[model samples]
Target: MADKHNDISSTELRANTPEQAVLSTPTDDIHVANGAADKSKNQKIRKATNIILIVVAFLFVFHLIADRYIPSTDLGRVRGFVVPITPQVSGEVIEILTTPNTLIRKGQVLARINPRDYEIALFTAEQNVTQAGQNMGALTANVTAAKAKVVNAEANFTNAKVQSKRIFTMVEQQVMSEADADNARAELASAEAGVASAKADLAKAEERLGSEGENNTAVKSALLALEQAELNLARSEIKAPTDGVASNFRLKEGFYANAGQPVMTFISSEDVWIEANFRENSLGNMQAGDKVEFALDYAPGEVFTGKVAYIDYGVDWGQSEQTGKLAQTTGQTGWLRQSQRFPVTIHFDDEEAKGLRRVGGQADVMVYTEENSLMNLFGKFWIRVVSWFSYVR
Candidate 1:
């Protein structure tokens, strides 16, 4: 019986050992759990690393955009000079020396008027002056001749007096007749009358000369007419006042140009500037002499530098709403007021590249300003108060 029980127990132990071997061998499960844990840790590490990288990239880009390359505001604009040319005299436009978009220099003749009429008028005026001078000269010569005649007459009168004296002495001595004395007296009287007439003629000539020298209305009128003729003559040739490009040149050969008529416009490309119509609110930090940078629509790649030249005296707020302004001018369009805009002029320092810019071209401008510490702090506090009040309301 003991031998039989031992054989059965050995067999059971062998079968149980196989089952235990299957349950106890846990190496594969351990490897799988270890792999899962490693994978989870790796995923968490990758997510954290990605988050860090994203933050770093964002900061770098934000810094670049803020410090180095700030976004431009298209609200800015470009401005330039616009001038009108008008004729001072009335005449036919004989020639047109410029075309549209043509570049020209200062003092360059853009057009000419029909100069024949002006020339003829000038010649007539000159002739009138010459004739007047000749007339004056003739009068002067006449006076000179009259003076000589007066001298001759005086001499004759003296001789007649001497003869009369001799005749009187003879009569007293009973050697000459009283008739001879009477005749000598009559001759002296005639000589004296002749001298008086000559002196009167000389005085008349002197008066004529004096009239021209002092308050001669007729001479003054003539001089004014002559001056007008000369001015008209000068107006025949249209010359530019400064070096610039001529535009709106509409006059052609043989076209009549009237007085005070618009001939053409001269745009000075040499003096370039940007007139920014900034809002009144935007002007709080803006001032003259502030640094500015600009970009032009025509030349997008170029960065033009400038400074604030001046700010407007007052804001134009009327029609400000329609015009999108922060302030309004008193006499502006509307009465039920809205926002208004003030104009600020900025002068460009670069002269070399000014020629490339055109009037009315759009430009973006930026005014460099330092933040005000007190103002900023006050503004933040005010904003928070306003927000709280809005919520309460």
Candidate 2:
């Protein structure tokens, strides 16, 4: 009975011992080491994640600075001067001398008007000038004849006066009859009246002849009419005023073109420019002579460089609209307002832009300011990417 109790107590003591003390083997050691290894790996992963996050944050900040300092806008367009072609004289279109989209030079004849009426007018004016000249010649002849008549009458009057004085003396000395003296007085009176009439006629003739040969009032007036007629005849041919391309050639044969009305639009080939509508915030560092790069939709995959030529001083806001008697105010939505864009004109550096005929075509523009940094390089890269994307988009 004592041996059995002792055996049972020993078994209970063995059963009550901890498992770690009873089973302290290699497997247990491996399990403990694996737990510690897992904890250390988690700490290393957290450290690496923290470092990556810091780098990403720094990069994001750098990109933001790049976008702000270097501004860009997609709302750009090719621009050129548009001229309205109008005729100075009203007439029927006798001929159309130009075709649509044809290049034209200054003073090139675009069309012709029916000049028959103008020619007839010019001929009539010339005939009137000839008639004026004939009339002037007749007046000059009349003046010369009147002068001769005045000289003859003056000689007769002088002889008559001498005879009257001799007759009066003869009557007073009783060497002549009273009837003879009376006859002599009558002849003298007739001669004096003739002389006075001749002088009046001469004065009238001289008044008709002006200071110079062609300075007669009638001749001058006729000459002016002739000049005007010639001018009108010349104006019958419509000519271009500048070098450009003729567009919208709608004038056909027999169409009556009104005076001073636009017949076509002429796009000047003098200089081409880009009109970029940039947000107000983007214009802070922008100025004239700033370098710019642009890509056109028509000329995709090609980047053209230029410089900022000018900035618009004003924009179309409430100030431009015609308002009522009361002043107008601009309405805005809360917090989510869009910035207004102003126009900035850019001029191309080379003549390559002249090859593009797409006026008002879409373009992407980037203005490189005086600030030279890595940000600009990024901006250039971004623009190149955009230019490439333009090919597919």
Candidate 3:
């Protein structure tokens, strides 16, 4: 009985011990080796992540510094269009040739005025010119006739003088009658009077001819009349001055309009540009002739190019004179004031602009005054240098 109990206990102990021991052998060894390798790998990964984060932080800080030192402005409100139109004559609207928002070419007829009155006035003026010319011609002919009369009068006076002298000699010798001599003397005096009359008539004719000659008052009146006629004729035709889209048509077809009244206005679509108003403080690095890059709210995915063409000389709120003193609130610390804004006009160099489009569309203009990093840094440095130099000098 004792031997049997001991054998069963030993068998149970061996069974439990062999299975447990065999199962734990490879697991324990593998667990120890894996733990060591994982610790090493985790340390390496953390170190690498920390190093990458540090580099990224440094780069971010550098970028912040660069942005603060460099001056930048968002000028998005500057835009304008060219207005080119003028009325040369005044008349009543008789015909309408264009509608609102219609595209018109250069020299296209825009409207017509009532031409009947103008045409009649032109005809009357032409008649006046023709009459003046005829009067001048008639005066010139009279001058020639008066000159001939003067020559005939002179010859008659000479012949009468000779005959009178002969008659006086005969009377002095008592071979001729006194009445005859007296009559001859009277004839000679009458002939001399005729010459004076003819001379006076010739002078009058010459004066009349001169009055109607070129550059004379009568001729000037005629020319003025002709010009007025031509102007009236021209007033009948209303034409566009340039290629543009018509707008603001206050007069319509068959509408009666007076002189100096505007019939319509047009906007050219080809000359569009952006006008950016940047703060005065942001102008330190800005200048004319700088290239610009810009975008528009209307057209997306399209990049536009332009050049800075002008900058305003001064800044003003453009308040009316009746308004009181102007002031603005800027968030800043005491003892310093914020800079004001001024306007700058940028011209687009794109083919779309050169094609005669109406400018004045709203756009944002960012001028690239400094293309390189070094240039941007040096520009700021130069401003500070000039500031210091001003104090020293």
Best candidate (score: TM-score): 2
lDDT (tens digit, per residue) of candidate 2 on 113-173: 9999999999999999999999999998999999999999999999999999999999999
Off-target runs (Cα >4 Å) in candidate 2 are: 1-70, 147-203, 206-214, 320-324, 333-336, 371-380
Top of the candidates by lDDT: 2
lDDT of 1 by residue, 226-273 (tens): 899999998898887667778766566888777886867788776667
| TM-score, per-candidate, Cα-based | 0.62, 0.71, 0.68
**Candidate models: Cα lDDT each:** 0.70, 0.86, 0.71
Model 3 C-alpha lDDT per residue in residues 1-393, reported as the tens digit of each score? 999999777666645777764555556779999999999999999999999999999878764444333434444553445453445566667777888777788888888887887788888888887888888888889999999999999999999999999999999999999999889989999999999999999999998878645665677798898898888788688887777777866775667666665666767655556667776666766788877665554454444667888888976654345556666554567655665778887787857434323344445445566666564554444333433332333
Give the CA lDDT, 0 to 100, for residue 139 in model 3. Answer: 86
Clashes of each: 13, 0, 11
By lDDT, is 1 or 3 better? 3
Candidate 2, residue 91: the lDDT equals 89
